[model samples]
Target: MVPQEAYRPDAGAMTTAIHVRGLTKRYGDVQAVGGLDLEIQKGEVFAILGPNGAGKSTTVEILEGYRKRDSGEVRVLGIDPQKPTREWRAKLGIVLQTANDAAELTVRETIRHFAAYYPMARDPEEVIAKVGLTEKADVRIRKLSGGQRRRVDVALGVIGNPELLFLDEPTTGFDPEARRQFWDLIKGLAAEGTTIVLTTHYLDEAEALAKRVAVIARGRIVAAGDPATLGGRATAKAKVTWADGLVETDTPTRTVLELSRRYDGEVPGLAITRPTLEDIYLTLIEAPE
Candidate 1:
């Protein structure tokens, strides 16, 4: 695991890594992206959350210069993605939702092969260790498990030592342990000043990695803020439940105190709950756009 110090950024420094204004995209009559505006800071891990066909992929593709937008101003790493240069492309690392790799190549060979493309690539052996693939380094790609293969995809993504990384559903097939390991790698990278943008269906993953989150729906961002407080979650009413009853109120602390007193210091089966990230995400996506 990466040391905790790596996650700390320079004190009070906020730089813009990605900027978008009046972004729009359409296919036939369907609007894929509609006037979406977003700004992500340097060295930040930002997550985009939304259901299928919600335009999350469309927006990301445009930002990556893989797709064209109908209208908008977009600047990634201080350059317009539409006019990508070799230097501009070199600074980016992208891990798509799915990729086709050379099935016959060993993990070590694959990493080495891709590393040659970057002028300042990381050491292949070190990259292998970072992604927890040292044991499978010599194994052919075709022989690895689904989750293990996913790790290779990540290894390739960070091999170039990119300044900005784009991860689309990065942990798709990872097991519980593997997922945790991947999170460590991401936190370590963020600590080292690599700006990361992530899109995932896992709310827990977003809460664990992203300092800020944006929820997209119907081709527009319906909500965006700190994951802990999105959609007024921070101040939403808490539910205090005990042995025989439950009460929803603004001050759960007061309710608990009264219950403790009434129960002579110990309330049976007492539980206090507030809106969780998943709860807020579901609510936001379901609301009318």
Candidate 2:
């Protein structure tokens, strides 16, 4: 849900779905988030990544109205999250890192019960099918596998028909297949105009789904941009590999062209690669705080 007392947007400002400026949070001497600023457009799948204790969760909690910020301005759907109201809460859905236990209830019963909380909830049967849990609808919660249980968690999150959805490390325990299915489900939701904010350690997952990514370290944002071009990544040097050895440089195309002349043909095992999101992320996090 969102806060009702935050600034109200004019018609033109409504284009941006989420906006945060100089956001900060502290616990005594420790700073959890230091003057963080971010903006997300509507219907965009944005990913936030960070090392442990980097204030990622804290920032998200503030956005979700689960926790209060010490300072800074934040807005979601034109409302301040800190002053969350019923109408604002109704427009947001959240899937936490861990779902609560309802061990004795069947999957269908659980979803049905939660659906009653929303004024415009999705159809229970449709949500179950969308999450690939139609077959487990009648199965008891305790008997379901970990991945299947996660699907149930997603079902509950979307049952509210929220305009914005927050997912924190959603596929932590899923296998490859289940993870793919979940990614597809997220894409489907975004396609339907749902704004999504996600946090995860899986760089590959971020690359696959996020239109843009933000990397945080030591309670501050280190880098933010498109996944492929974060931190000048697209313009960074490429690593060139050949049968003899490998070399890294900014002019990969020139290197390949010269190598082709030297070899009089295609160079054996010739490959060119740029730094991956994970590589850049690790480098950013390990830098001096």
Candidate 3:
């Protein structure tokens, strides 16, 4: 695993995959997005996090060409999404938060149907296998478990062999083990050089899958950086706790050593912790504009 600190914005000479400048959208009196600017590098797994009505959904929809933006420049895969061509659309894949309407088609049949839409599609059976649905390839969509049907959703998304994939809460209803399996599948896709844009409410999911994350609130980005370092979290003071005492300090190691010496051995119930990604996210979103 790459260390979290290694995900700095300027770590490499990266190519741009998606770029937006001064993006804005308004819904009557409420501004859904306001002057948002972002850039995602090729092959990077980037996450956008926010509560409902924070404009993340609007931003993502604009990038996906599902919604029109009022103003600002936007480019996805080097083409303006506003004027997307058939060829450009073919290069993208999307896995929405909700699964497609419950289908009667079997896994293999569904994959094959979507494969026909792309110019260079992966083999249907191969796509099914890639999503760990080989055993369920012959099963009808309505017959599979929730997690199994989710795997079918993923198979359809990837069958197009897209250069970029947008996953919107891909594991929303998944159990722990199922979520882990999904993460592995996503990692495999990222390793194959597919740029991924993920939107998830689960902070741990963002931390596990995204190299970098942007926190949006009230239609603006309040924080954007490596997940570990967002909102200065990486440098935040650690809280050192023991059986009867606790102290917050920049030098947690020194505090632990002192506690050990005072106790003449290991400190009882000793623990050290920094602010988690969730902790930082809460602060960012709840802060005043």
User: Against the correct fold, how does model 3 do in TM-score?
Assistant: 0.92
Q: Could you say which candidate leads in TM-score? A: 2
* lDDT, ranked from best to worst: 1, 2, 3
Please, what is the whole-model Cα lDDT of each candidate in the order they appear?
Answer: 0.92, 0.92, 0.91
Q: Taking the tens digit of each residue's C-alpha lDDT, what string does model 1 give over 130-214?
A: 9999999999999999888888888899999999999999998788998998899999999999999999999999999999999
lDDT of 3 by residue, 38-97 (tens): 989999999999999999989999999999999998888878888989998899998877
Cα misplacement distance, residue 125 of candidate 2 (Å): 0.6
Worst 10 residues of 3 by lDDT: 5-14
Query: What shift in Å separates residue 182 of candidate 3 from its native position after superposition?
Result: 0.7
Each model's TM-score?
0.92, 0.93, 0.92
The window of 10 residues in a row where model 1 has the poorest summed lDDT is: 5-14
| Superposed model 2: Cα runs more than 4 Å off | 1-9
127 Cα displacement, candidate 1 (Å) = 0.7
Please identify model 1 stretches exceeding 4 Å from their true place. Answer: 1-14
